[model samples]
Target: MDQNSAKEGKGLSIIAYITIIGVLIAFFMNQEKKNSFTFFHIRQSLGLWLMYFIFGYVISGFDSWMLTYSFWIFFAVLFLYGLLGAISGKANSIPILGDFFQKLFKSLGN
Candidate 1:
């Protein structure tokens, strides 16, 4: 939680938001150091990617461009929010599902 820790983990934390693969890479990379900042972003990105895939499957059934665009935009904003937080070395969570992600992935960094 200290600035030094955050600074140390900043690169991997940003990488965590790149994609699900990035999440895996970041997770494994952090295993050695066990950076909490990196793990926090990993959990957030993992949850976001999982939700995106699940919702994308459901959204595919709909032919509405509005729904599709909305889905894309929604996830985009959330990703951006998390990415910026990581870049800034802050541990802020995504808006609504952030708390759930932290709780769901509570065992991640342990």
Candidate 2:
């Protein structure tokens, strides 16, 4: 998609990834006008945030530099991947977990 068409849903797409509150706001924002691009991002961001919490709890016991950095880098990359896609107006799923997220949140985003 070109920049112009991408611009339409970029705002809500980025907003959905900002925070939990932002996700809810973006959800409602796109309720009236459903933008597939924004919805795709919302699903990805929601999946990322949910995984962040799940991993946080699971990794709390493992105190190691390798684990620490790996965890941070993994999520960071995922976040950046989605954010950049949104900025560029692309509907690319994050990477590994993206497709699953899209499927999981399909009902809501649609």
Q: Estimate each model's TM-score.
A: 0.99, 0.90
lDDT of each: 0.97, 0.86
Between which residue pairs do clashes occur in model 1? none
User: Which portions of model 2 miss their true places by more than 4 Å?
Assistant: 1-5
Where does model 1 exceed 4 Å of error? none
- Residue-pair clashes per prediction, in order, are 0, 0
Summarize candidate 2's per-residue lDDT along 31-95 as a digit string, tens digits: 98787788888899999999998997888789887987899899999998888888878989888
Measured with C-alpha atoms, the lDDT of residue 13 in candidate 1 is 97
Model 2 TM: 0.90
> Which digits, one per residue and each the tens of the lDDT, describe model 1 over residues 1-110?
88988999999999999989999999999999999989999999999999999999999999999999999999999999999999999999899999999999999999
